[model samples]
Target: MTDAAPAIAAAGLRKSFGALEATRAVSLAVPPGGRHAIIGPNGAGKTTLFNLLSGALRPDQGQVLLGGVDVTREGPDGRARRGLARSFQRNSLFAEMTVAAALMTASAIADGGSAVFWRRFDRDAARAEAAAAIAARVGLADRLEELSGNLAYGAQRQLEIGLALATRPAVLLLDEPTAGMSPEETRAMQDLLAGLPRAITILVIEHDMDVVFDLAERVTVLDYGAVLLEGTPAEIRSSDLVRRRYLGERTQ
Candidate 1:
């Protein structure tokens, strides 16, 4: 990985589900430390593009590069090992575990520690401390002992992000971190994401225009499985094509 390389890039990525082409020649490059967002209406292929980039699905064409190294062939775990981490829109949690325990487990796995069922997690003081720090970072420090399944919807989302952070990713891909949150929760999540270290590049797929406009330095608009436009937030907001295709505006 060179200093000048993009944190993540896709070149001519294409995917088809049988007869339907999901992503049509989609391509993007997110520079190191860049904050970017992908937005579109329903069925715009945003999820398919994310799957290809995260190695959840292989692209029918083109390549996925992480830190400029081609990773098209790598699976999700392999990409994770290479400093790419992703958070899903739905909750992925250990329902039976405490918030601290869940983060500790994720951190331990990321550090190559095997799960030894016979041992207590807290016995590993460093891992516990790391988990606590992650809990703090994600705004769950005060809820470390709470059962993960019992957390409020917003806190669960925060913990989901904490799980991703445990991997210490160089590039983080978030799938609608603010989804399903109240306005207050959304604002809190936004601030938490905004406060993340600039050393980590972020690429998010979001439907909330407020979050998109506020959090993303650059935005990519997708329509009908292809990029409608890619530009700064100001450019994207003011784009006549974007307005017509995505924002539901009629031409004068």
Candidate 2:
């Protein structure tokens, strides 16, 4: 493994909603191109930690680092500009827009261009090409002309990832990408994520234990708003602490 600085790092992060302490001194470090999964019980502050990392919510204390540079103060847009992108728990799509149009719009925005209309593409061949490439990468090339809302639920999720990929992000944060998916859809999503190049560092929050174990090279378990354990899947599965706290399994 290379010794490059961590692609994403959280140092002593904390967040509170007045009476509720959502995150308590949580910290993480994900190496470049690493596939890391965060698994936690409900109310364990997974979402809160995600928000702080994405700049959606500022930490009440501590710092966020991107490629070893402090970015705790940067907003979401700023982070995006510096190669960070995220997909939410719910699909975020331009419902009325065609897949091609939506992808083009996202690509244009990433490049600091006016994404007013796809019809006005004569002068934006680069944007169009980038969008097409992203479509192929996300398995949406065949659905380019289809309305985003009209695509199958799984396809819609694929498009959601495509939108994020359009930004050409170096680091991707996926929040429950398969939350509402069927077993088949979940498998497809897993395959899609597995096929992603190592050029992108991935961090995911997922409820599906199978998905977490399948995709993650390293796993972090959270309980009561703090890290309970971190290790390879085998280590975590064998840990009585993780089994009791997060997996809810009876352990000897």
- Among these predictions, the greatest TM-score belongs to 1
Instruction: Residues 1-252, candidate 1: write the lDDT tens digits.
Output: 636989999999999999999999998999999999999988999989989999999999999999889999999989999999897333444667788888887777787875454146657788789889989999999999999989999998998999889879999999888888999999989988888889899999998888888989999998889998999999998988898788764223
TM-score, candidate number 2: 0.93
Residue 112, candidate 2: C-alpha displacement in angstroms: 1.4
lDDT (Cα atoms) of all candidates against the true structure: 0.87, 0.86
Per-candidate TM-score against the hidden true structure: 0.93, 0.93
Query: lDDT of candidate 2?
Result: 0.86
Q: Distance (Å) between predicted and true CA of 33, model 1? A: 1.0
Scanning candidate 2 in windows of ten residues, the lowest lDDT window is 87-96
